[model samples]
Target: MNHEVIGGIPVLWADAPGPLEAVLMFGCGVQDETLRTLGTTHMVEHLAMSTLPRLHHEHNASVDLLTTQFTCTGRPEQVVAFLAAVCEALTALPLERIEQEAGVLAAEDGRVADPATAELLSHRYGVQGLGLAAYRGPGADRIPVEAVQEAVDRFFHRGNAVLVLTGPPPADLRLPLPDGERPDRSAALPVLRTGPSWREEDVPGPGLALHGDLDDPALQLACKLLSQRLRDTVRHRHGLSYDVGGDAVLAGPGHGERTLCLDAREGQEQRVAELLWEEALRLARECPTEDELAEEIAELREVYQDPRSTTCELGEAAGALLFGGTYQDPQTRLAVLEKVTPDEVRQAFAAALETVLLVVPCGTEVDPKLPDGRPLPRRACGTEGELPPGAKVFRPPLVDRLRSSDARRARLAVDGRGLWAREPDGTVHHVPFTEVVGVEMRGPGRVVFGRDTCVIPVVPELWAGIGPAVDAVDAAVPGQLRYPASAFRPAD
Candidate 1:
C-alpha cells in the first residue's frame, strides 16, 4: 500500500486488477447523532449524492453505524469527478432539496444492522451512540436544517476524512473539503448492561451478543466457530433454520460487540433459540477441536487473500486511522490467528459469555439458564416496583378502569425531577427531565424518551386529567429537544 496527501486529505491507495475504485470516507455516522437527530447523517449523505448528475459509472453513498462512505468504480477521470463533486456538495449542501430528499429517504427505509443485532446493541448501550440502531427516531422531514449543518461541520471536513483507492490517484484528483478537527471518539460508549441474560423481541429468529475486545483473535475465531457449528446442527442436521450469520461491530479502539444470529424455520422459534444458547454454552464449557479451528482459519485466509479485497483492506486501514485504532494487515492478522490454540479460543469465548445478551423472538417462551444452574433474568425498562414519593399521580379514567382490570392498575406520575409511569404489571419506568433526549409531541400527548432507554407516555388515553403531566414535560424539557410528531407517522 502507498500513502499520499491530496488537497488536505490523507489518501491511501494500492494496485489492483480492475477499474480504479475510490471511497471517500468520513468518521461520522449514526453514532454521532442524538435521538432527536437520528437520521441527520443519512440525510446529509443523501443531500450530497442528490447533487451529482447522472453518470455512466457505478456509484453510491452509504451511512452505517460508525462511518459514511461515498464510493465509485470507473476510469481515473470519472473517479476524480465523482470525488470532487462529493466534496463540493458537502461544503455547501442544497438545503432547498432537503424536503424532496426526505421523501426519498423515507421511501428507502434502510437499516444499518439486522433487527436482532440492533436490539442487542440497544440492550448494551441504551438509546445513544451504537445503541441508536434499534430506534427509528424522528422522521426525515422533521430533521432540522441546523442539525444537518452541524453534522456536516463536525464530521465532513478534511480533518475527519480519508480517501482509499484500488489504484494510484489520477493527476486531476482533488478533495476540496473544508478544514476542521476530527471529533474525539476515543472514549467507549457507556454500557447499560454487561449481562448473561435474554429477552424476547420482535425478531425473525434468535440472536446473541457478547461484549469483548475487538482485536482479540481468539474471540473472533470463537464467533466464527459458533456460527459454523450452528450452521451444521441447526441447518443441515435438523433443518430447523435456513441461515446463520454473525458480525463484529467496533465501538472503540479495543472494545466492541460480537453477534451471532439465525433465521429459524416456521414454528421453530423456541427450538432455534434453545439450540443457539445450547451451542454457545457448550462452546464456552469445552474447547473446539483442531479441525474446527483450522476450518475457520482457512476460510478467513481465503477471504484475505482474494485479489478483489484490496479496496476492502484499504477501507479498514482508513477506519483505524480515523478512529484511533491499530490497523493490522491481512497477513499479520492471519499470522496471529494461526498461533491461537483451542484452549485460548475456549477461554476467550467463556469470558465473553459472562457479558452475553440474548434475544429471542417475541411470544417465544424461554428460560435460558447459565451453566451454574442460575436462570438468566428477563430484561425490562424499569426496576422499581412502585412510584416515587411526592409524585402527582394520575390514574386511568373511571370508564376505562371499570371496563378492564388492567386499566385500574396503570398510573402516571410527575415530579419536579422527572416523569414516571407504572405499568399494569407494576413495573415503574422513570425518565428524568434532565436526561430527556427527545420528546415527540403527539397531538395532545407527549412521548418522552430518556437517555437510558426509558420511555414515558404523557398521553391522555392512558390516564385521566393528564394536563398537569403534559405541562410538566413541556416546561421541564428544553424547546430544542421537542418536536411535533412527524406527519408521516400514524396518529395516536
Candidate 2:
C-alpha cells in the first residue's frame, strides 16, 4: 500500500482496476455517543451529505458501531470534489437543517446490526459502547443541538480521520476539517456477561455469540465453517432456514465478539435453534476435517486474490491504524491460515464456547448443553431476590391487582441510593442514581436506564401513584442525563 499525508490527514491508497473509489473514515461512530445522544454521529453524516448537490457519481455515507465512512466512486475530479465538499460540510455543518434531517433520519430508521446480533451485544455489554446497537435511545427529533455540535467538535476532524482510495490522490484533493486530537478509546468496554448461557428475544431466528480474540484465524475459520454447515443442513437439506449470516465486531485491540445468526422457517424456530446449538457443540467436540478446513481456506484465498478487493484491504488497514489493531496483509494472513490444524481450530472454538451466548426467538423453548454435558443456563437481567430494606414501595393499581395474581406480587421501590423493581417471579432490578446513564421522560412517567443494563419503569400503568417516584428520580439524576421520551416509541 502507498501512503501519503494530504491536508494533515493520513491517506492510504493502492492501485486497482476501477473508477476512482474513495472512502474517508472517521474513528468515531455510534459507540461514541451517549444514550441521550445516540444518533448524533448518524445525524452528523446526514447533515453533511444533505449539503451535497446532485452529481453523476455513486456516493454514500454510513455510520456503524465503531466508525463513520463517506465513500464515492467516480472520475478523479469527481472524487476530489466529493471529499472536499464532505470535509467542508463537516467543518461548518448546516445546523439549520437539523429539524428537516431528523425527520429524514426517523424515516430511515437504520439499524447497525440485525435483531439477534444486536440483542446478543446488548446482553454481553449492557447499554453502553457496542451494546448501544440494541437500543433506539432518544428519537432523532429529540437530539439536542448542543449534542450535535459537541459530536462534531470531538470526532469529526482531521486528526481522527483517514482517507483510503483505489488510486493515487488527485492534485486538487483537499481535506479542510478542523484540527483536533484523536479521542482515547484504548480502554475496552466492560463485559457484562462471559456466558455459556441462552436467552429468548423477539428475533426472527436463533443466534450465537462468542467473546474471544478477534484476530484468531482459527476462530474466524470456525465461524466460517459453522455458517457453511448451517447453510447446508438448515437451508438446503432440511429446509428449516433460509439464510445464515454473522459478523465480527471489534471492541478493542485483539478483542471483540463473533456472532452467527440464522433465520428459521415458521413453526420450526425451536428445532432450528436446537440444530444450530447441536452443530456448534459437534464442531467444538469433534473438530473439523482436513477437507473442511481446506475448503474454507480456498474460499478465503479466492476473496483475497481478487483485484477488486484492493480497496477493501486498504480500508481494513486504515481502520486498524485508526483504532489500535494489527493489520495483516492478505498473503501473510493466508500463510497463517494454511498452518492452522484441525485440532487448533477445535481448541480455539472449544475455548470460545465457554463464552457463548445463545439467543432464540421468543416463545421458543431451547435446552442447549455444552460439550461436557452441562446444561446452558437461562440468562436474565436482574437478581433473584426481594427488594432492599427501608425502601418506599409502590404496588400495581388496586383494581388491576384484583384481576390478576401476578399484578398483586409485582412492585417498585425507591431508596436513598437508587430505584428497584421486583417482578412477580422475584427478580429484582436496581438502577442507582449515580450510575444512571439516561432517564427517558414518558408522558407522566420515567424509565430509568442504568449502566449495568438494569431498567426500572416508574410508569403509572404498572404502579399506582408514581408521581412521588418520578419526582425523586428527577431530583437525583442530573439534568443532563434526562430527556423526553421518543415520539416514535409507544408508552411502556
Candidate 3:
C-alpha cells in the first residue's frame, strides 16, 4: 500500500486491481461521549450514513471504542462516490431525522447485550470512558439535533480522519471537508478502583474472564497459549466447556487489553474455574515448549500470507496512523515474532497476574485460590474533604425517582466541594469537587456528577431548592463540564 495526502487528509491506497474496499475513519466514538451524551457519536454516525443514496455497493457505518468509520465495498468509482457523499452528509448533518435514527439505535442496543463482555469491562473500568458499555444506552430520546451537530463539528474533520483504499484510488477523488485540528483522545474517565477487582453477574452459565495491558508481543502470545491450554483441558479432555478464546482490545498505542474467556456447561462451574487457574498458573511459572511456540508462530505467519492479507492490514495501518500507534507491517510483525523467546512469554504472563480482573457467574462458587476477592464498593474511592454548604439532601421515594422494593435508602447531599450519599445506617460516600471531571443533565430533572470513581445520579425533584443548589455547583465546575439536556423524550 502507498501513503499520500489528499485535501489535507491522510490516504493509504493499494493497487490490488480488483473490486475495491475503502473506509474513511474518524478518531471519535463512544469514548468521546459522556453518560448523558452516551449515544451522540453513534447518533451522528447513523444520521450521516442515513443521507447516503442507494448505490450498488455494500456500505455501512460502525462506532467502536475510539473510532467511527464508514466503509464501502464495490468498484473503485462507486466506492469513491459513496465516500464523497458520506463526507458531504457529515458536513451538513440532517438533524430532522435524529428522533427516527435514535429509535433505530435503541433497538440495536437491545439486540446485542453480551452481558459477559459488558460486565467484565464495567467491573474492570467502571461506567466511565471506555467502560460505558456496561451501562444502559444513552437516553436516545433525550438527544437533540444541536448536540449531534456539535459532535460532527468537533470530531468529523479532515485533520482527525483517514481514507484507506484497498484496490485502487479513484481519479479526481476529492473530500471537501472543513479545516479543523486533529482532536486528541478523550480524557481518561475515572473508575471506582484501578487495582485488581472482581465482580459476579447473573449470566447464562459459568465463565471466566481476564484482562491486562499489551506490553509486549510475548504477552500477546502468552494469552493465546493460555487460552489454548484452557480449551484443551476443559473442552477436549473433560467436556466442561464448549468455547474458549482470547481477544485483544488494541484501541491505540500503549492502551490495549487482552481478554481471556471460557464458557462452561451448567454444572462445570467449579471445574472450569479450577482448570482456568491451573493453566494460567502453569503458564506464569514456565514458558511454552519450543514446538508449541513454533506452532503459534507458524499460524501467525499463515494469517499474513493469505491472498487478502494486505487488504485486511490496510484499515489497521490507517487506524494506527490516526491513533498515534505503532503500525507493524506483516514483515515487521514476523520479525518481532522471531525475537519473542518462550522465557519472555513466561515472564509476561507472570507480570500480567498482578492486575487481573475476574468475572464469574453470580450463583456459582469457585476458588482460583488467589488473593481474597474484594467486592465492588458502593461509594467513591479516595474522595476527601468536608461537605460544602447550601447542600440539598434527598432521601429515597422522592418524586419521580426510580427505586427497587428493597433498594438501600440514602441521603444525597449536593454542595460546592462535592456531593455525598449516606445510607441510613451512617455509611457515607463522598465525591470531591476536585475529582469531578464533568457534569451532565440526563433529563430535565436528573443530574449526573462525573467523578473519578463513578457517575452519581441526582434527581432535582427529590430535593428542595435543587435549582439554586445546582446553579452553585455549576459555577464551581468548568463550563465544558456540563451538557445541556436534549429536547426529545420517549413516550411512556
TM-score, one value per model: 0.98, 0.97, 0.80
Candidate 1 lDDT over residue span 1-492, tens digit each = 899999889999999998999999999888888899999999999999999999999999999999999999999999999999999999999999999999998889889899999999998988999999999898888999999999999999999999999998899899999999998878887887989778888899999999999899999999999999999999999999998989989888789999999998889999999999999889989999999999999999999999988888999899998999988999999999999999999999989998999999988998888876788888977875778889999998899999999999998999899988888888889889998999999878899999888888888778889898899999999999999988777855
Q: In model 1, which residue pairs have backbone atoms overlapping below 3 Å?
A: none
Taken over the whole model, the C-alpha lDDT of each candidate is 0.92, 0.92, 0.69
Candidate 3, after superposition: displacement of residue 381 in Å? 9.3
Model 2 alpha-carbon miss at residue 374, Å: 1.8
Model 2, TM vs. native: 0.97
423-470, model 3: which lDDT tens digit per residue? 544556666667665565645444555434355555554553456546
Model 1, position 75, has a per-residue lDDT of: 94
Tens-place lDDT digits, model 2, residues 146-235: 999999999999989999999889988988898999987687878888997898999999999999999999999999999999999999
Q: Give the runs in model 1 whose Cα sits over 4 Å from its true position.
A: none
Question: Model 2: runs farther than 4 Å from truth?
Answer: none
